[model samples]
Target: MSAELPQPSTTSLADRVKNILIQPKDEWGRIDAEPATVAGIYKSYVVPLAAIGPVAGLIGMTVFGVRVFGLSYRPSFGATLSTAVAGYIAALIGVYVLAMILNALAPNFGGQKSEVQAMKVAAYSCTASWVAGIFQLIPALAWLAILGLYSLYLLWLGAPRLMRVPQDKAATYTIVTIVAAIVLFFLVGLVASSVTSMFMPRMPLPGGTLSVG
Candidate 1:
């Protein structure tokens, strides 16, 4: 709640991380003061990792010894831990982008400032990414299951937040924001995946043409 920069709970690093990584939608203040902008709400959602990412990665690596040598809990069948991590990262980026879109478009549903509130929504989303990534180092279909659950849970949580619009337009905003955000996310994901697919390497055909077609 520091005015300098809207911060998550300052109790401790772990607690702050929890706020950023899980409970990201709420803010101590309804509006930001210093920036004299409405976007603080959205950007606050982005700021948590301003400190957590590097520090947490360092601590995690140090404590875990930079390798999962004996992680009995991790799945060990198909893809290596690295690939699972890669997939998780991909999903994270997709979700973050979706959150941004929601922040921008959903606010219309609520009549709130999209620019600032995006930060909170984005933070709230990391919860699913981390929860799935918990054992993502393992390679199985489990990641898919977790991802599905994460998507559902976000919508469930977000629906309420989206509805709390000013001027008493709560119900309309809730349905519009929640539904629009989800639709836009999938649309964005398809566009993104297609673009990435274009850059993917393709094997040569029997006649030696490299066409993905």
Candidate 2:
């Protein structure tokens, strides 16, 4: 009988998040070598982290409400819930699609294509944005969520390392990948907004009426 190979160790989600956020350069190295299935990554990491934004947004919009031009407007529960759910689903799909794009573009950048590595890059790079979702809990502080743009920097650092892209071409690769992701998410947002608007209710304001959704 042959001996079984040792199983790779798993890090707790908190530790993984801390490491990736604090020391991403080192963390990406571990992530590259870690044995992980796509489903495992999604279930353990992506699903929970991605929920932070949508859930927080739902609570913020319904409870704290949105303030614009000294007027406050609260969206209906149904509209808020539907938008949250749609956004959450879109985020999940976005990550998978991003990984595919990364893998497909590898050859153009002189990189080796590995689906698993691409997935790791896609999921881990989003850690900053997902964690920043906490800012969405307070409508007033929602603008802080822009801090999630740090994810782009994380991707720039991780892509060449994990995808084996040539150092000289890493910047171009990251830029192209980012542009593609932006277009994908923009389209997803338009669709989600259109669908969710059907549930929105009109709110009466001082000067006019507004719809919050």
Candidate 2, residues 154-207, lDDT tens digits: the string is 888888789999999988998999888778768877877776666553444343
> Would you list the C-alpha lDDT of every candidate in the order shown?
0.42, 0.84
Cα deviation at 65, candidate 1, in Å, is 23
Clashes of 2: 0
Local error of candidate 1 at residue 97 (angstroms): 3.9
lDDT of 1 by residue, 1-213 (tens): 755854443344355445433554442132222232334422443334332322333233323322223332211212123332343344546545655655666567554555444544444444444444344222332234256346445544553454245645555655565566567557744764454333332322132122111
TM-score list, all predictions: 0.46, 0.87
Clashing pairs counted in every model: 11, 0
All-Cα superposition RMSD per candidate? 10.0, 3.9
TM-score of 2: 0.87
In lDDT terms, how accurate is model 2? Answer: 0.84
Indicate the worst ten consecutive residues by lDDT in candidate 2. Answer: 204-213
